[model samples]
Every structure is written in C-alpha cells, then in structure tokens.
Target: MATDLVRAFVREDLKKSDVVAEVVSLVTVLEQEDFRKLLQEFVDGIDQSMLLDVHLLNGLVQLIRNAPQGYIDVDDLVKILGLLNTRLKDTHKQSTRHTYQLALTISQVLDSMVDSQVKGLSREQLHEPLSDYLEELKQDQDPYLVYQATYAY
Candidate 1:
C-alpha cells in the first residue's frame, strides 16, 4: 500500500515533488523494516536526477533531519545527501537570499538531527556542503546572510 501510494504520488504532476517529504511523514512512526522497504521502493522508483533541484532536495534533507527513528534507512539517507551536495555545487552564483535559505535549511536540519534520536547522515557528511556555504556566505555583504551563516557555522 505504501509502495503504491508513493508510486502514485511520483506519477502525479503536481504532487511528485512532494513525494519525498510525504513518504517521510507516513513512515515516521512505522517499524524499521517497513520504513526500509518503503524508502527503498521510493529510492528505486524515482529518478535520481529529479532530486537535483534544490527545492526537492531541501524537502528530502529536511525530512530526514526531522523524521523519527524509523523513517529512513542510512543508505537512502546518504543517497539523498549526495544528491543535495551535487545540486549545491555551484550555489555560489545564486543570490545571497537563496544561499542563506539553503544554508539555513541545511543548518536547521543538522540541528534537528542532533535534537532527535533518529539516525541518518553523519555530521561529517552534512558539514562538507555547509562549510562551502559558510565560505560563500562570508563574501556576502548582507548582514542577514552573515548573521545566519555565523549562527549556523
């Protein structure tokens, strides 16, 4: 049932982008085995490239960061983080506001994971892109961006 629902969401033109987060929410309170299968099905069914968009990637990252203990498997979580890293590679060209949003999202996710007992990407893995974001943020003249980066850094 979860697999079918996930597939349906992926097929829906308007809802496809929301699939990652919805799946995360659905499986949060489920058993580990169930969570693993649902997440594996989701990962296997979606095109990896679709996650390269920052909006979708943000949803996935935030979901993993905020989800409960059984919501996503380590392998799937790693794959999502990898996608985010790939998408964020050239983010320096984006506006400060955009960079700040991305950095803040990643930072909040990292912070949430610390507060939760859920397991997913290691701190080392998330910090790589964050470090880059902080470096980029350092060059921005906007005090808001600087403040956010400093707080997140």
Candidate 2:
C-alpha cells in the first residue's frame, strides 16, 4: 500500500517539484519496514528502467534529510550511493537537459547526506566513489555538471 501510494504519485502528471514534495511527505510517515520496501522498490525500478526519475531521487533525498538518526543504516546508504554512481555513469555520455537535471538532483542528494551526517555512514565508505564521481562530473562540458561538481567539491 505504501509503495502503491508512491507509484501513484510518480505516475501522476503533476509538476516535478510537486511530485517530489508529495513523495517526501509520504515517506516521512512510513514505518521502517515500509520505508525499506519502498527503497528496495526504488532500486528495482532503477534497475529495470536504467534511468533515475528526478522526482523520486529528490524524494529519497528529503527522506534521508529528515529521517531520525539511525533510520537509514549503512546497507541502505550503500545501495543509494551505488544507484547514484550508476546513474552518473549511465548519463555521462548524454548532455541533454534531462541529464543535466539529473546531475543537479544527484548533487542535492549527496549534499543532504552530508548535511544530515547520516548514521552508520562512514567517511571511508563515501570517500573513494564520491571523489571519483566528482572528478568525472568536473570533466563534463555541461555548465550545470561543472557547477554541481564544484558545489559538491
């Protein structure tokens, strides 16, 4: 039921910003098990689509930002980071407006994690991949990618 609510919101023709806000609101009230299921569904959705929906990405960021300490464990963080890395690489060769949007959203998600100081997430685990991702983003010709990379740096 919780996952269905999220899917319904995602499928709605609402504005991207509105979709994100709605998802965030819904995510905040979900029980831990429900949240985990939603996250797994999100991972599966990305695996099948090979594209990260900006609304969903932003929603997840908000959830991370507002979640209680220890709500998101290390394993969950790993999955989220892995998904971000994959999307970054998958979109690297494409310089469309959508890809630029994805890059900016990715930056926001990363920023939220840092600002929240997510429990059970270690610097050692974050350092290498994040460094590599930023380095790659810095090399992009797109101004938005450069700005995001710089902001993240």
Candidate 3:
C-alpha cells in the first residue's frame, strides 16, 4: 500500500500548501533522519508497479521545486538525488522530465544556490543528479519546461 501511505502522507495536514514557506516546512521534515524511514515506508506501502507512473514522480519533483532556498538539507538532497539517479539510470524518459523540471526550479532560486550542482552536468557529475532531468527538460514536450531550460542561460 505504498499509494495508500503516500496518499495519507500527502493528505496529512502537513502536505497541503502552494506557498514556498509551507513547502520549506515540509523540507524540514525531510531533513530529519526519521523522514527517510517514513519515505521508504510510504513508498513500500505502495504497489511497486505503480512506480512506473509519472504522476507520483511528478508530485515529488513539484515538492522539491516548492522547497525554499538554503533549506535543502543533506538528507533531503539524498532523497531527491537518489530518486533522480534511479529513475534516470533506467532511461525513463518521462520520469526524467519531471526531474529536469525540479532542477530548473531549484536553479532559479534567485540566489542560484543549486546552479553549481545542476549546470551542464554529466551523468557522472550529477552532484545533484542533474543529467537526465535537465536533458529531458531542455528538449521537452512542454514549452514551459523548454523555457525553463533557457532561463538558466
């Protein structure tokens, strides 16, 4: 019941927020070691096959994108980068797109805090796991994602 847990977690009074402030609060939870176990539990609670769907992946990217600057702690980075590495290594095109969008958002953090990690990155140099995600977005079906690619330039 990974979906169930994700649903419960997402529906928690904790997950509902469009503003960056609320998102930062969520990121704080991710910074805690307990959050890793919770996330694995949440994923394990779901049907493994559902991992193929881009919706869940999309939601994850959205979550990271919504995080506030300087709040992306190492634990949070571990979760985000690990997922991106796994999805991209498998050559999941659409899944990679979601990651790219996440990078684009982070790169635009006004202060460019994520820039050194994300720019012109190779798969091996993915300090932030930047390859497949950025590549897919740079050449995406969505214009906004495309626009987002150049925004870094």
Candidate 4:
C-alpha cells in the first residue's frame, strides 16, 4: 500500500518531495523486513535516465540518506555508487554547472553512507572506486569539482 502510494506520487507530473519524505518516514516505522523491502524497491527503481533530473535524483538521495543502517545491503550500495560514478563521468565531460552540483550531491551520499556505518560495507568496497573518482575530479578544469573532490578527500 505504501509502496503503491510512493510510486503514484513519483509518477505524478508535479511530484512533492515532502510527500515522499513523509512516506519514507512512515515506512521507517514498519517492521524491519518491510522497511528493507521499501528500501530495495527504491534502490531497484533507480535508472540512468533518472540521473539527469535533479528532482528525481534528490528524491532518491533523500531516501538513501534517511534509510536505516543494515537495511541498505552491499549490492544496493554498489548499484547506487556505480550509477553515480557513471553519471559523474558523463557530466564531467559536459563541463556544466550541473556537474558540480552532482559532485556535491554524490559526495553527500557517500558521506551519509559512511557516517551511517552501513552493516557489512567494507572499506575495500568503497575505497577503490571513491579514490578513482576523486582523483579524476581533481584533474578536472572545474574549480568547484576540484574543490569538492579535495573537500571530500
């Protein structure tokens, strides 16, 4: 029921972030299994097409940021990180303001994941890709991207 509502809300022409946040807050009160299911649904629903839309991206980021520890598994994190990495690479080539925004957003997501101390998330899983991404960012001509990369480091 809640998942259906969330889907409906997201499909609407005028999506409301507050509504989505409220739904997430409600889901967090559910039993652990149900909460995990919702998180899985949100993560699985993400796609490359959604990356360019800031509203949709923000919604997804909020969901991940608010998720309880242990609910977001290794595979889910890998998927999210992979998508962000791909988008970051593509956006960097374009060299638009959106690239910096995305970099900051991705940095926040990474920070949240690390700060949350997600269960079973090993340093090996996070370090290599993040290191590579940051290194790439440091080489970019965009001062914002370089600053973000340095700050993230």
Candidate whose TM-score is highest: 2
- Report, for every candidate in turn, its global Cα lDDT versus the true structure: 0.56, 0.65, 0.45, 0.64
Q: Kindly give the number of clashing pairs for every candidate.
A: 0, 0, 6, 0
Give the TM-score (vs. native) of candidate 1: 0.56
Question: In candidate 3, how many clashes are counted?
Answer: 6
Clashing pairs in 1: none
Give the per-residue lDDT digits (tens) of candidate 2, residues 12-99.
5443667557666776677776666656655555556644566666666677767666667756666677667667667746655655
Ranking of candidates on TM-score, top first: 2, 4, 1, 3
lDDT of 1 by residue, 22-109 (tens): 7666654555565555544444433344433444545545455655664554555446445445445555645665666655655665
Query: Which should have the higher TM-score, number 2 or number 4?
Result: 2
Decide which is better by lDDT, 3 or 4: 4
Error of 2 at 103 (Å): 3.3
In model 4, where do residues sit more than 4 Å from their true spots? 1-4, 10-46, 92-94, 116-130, 139-143
Total colliding residue pairs, candidate 4 = 0
In angstroms, what RMSD does candidate 3 have relative to the true structure? 7.8
The predicted structure with the larger TM-score, 1 or 4, is: 4
TM per prediction: 0.56, 0.67, 0.40, 0.64
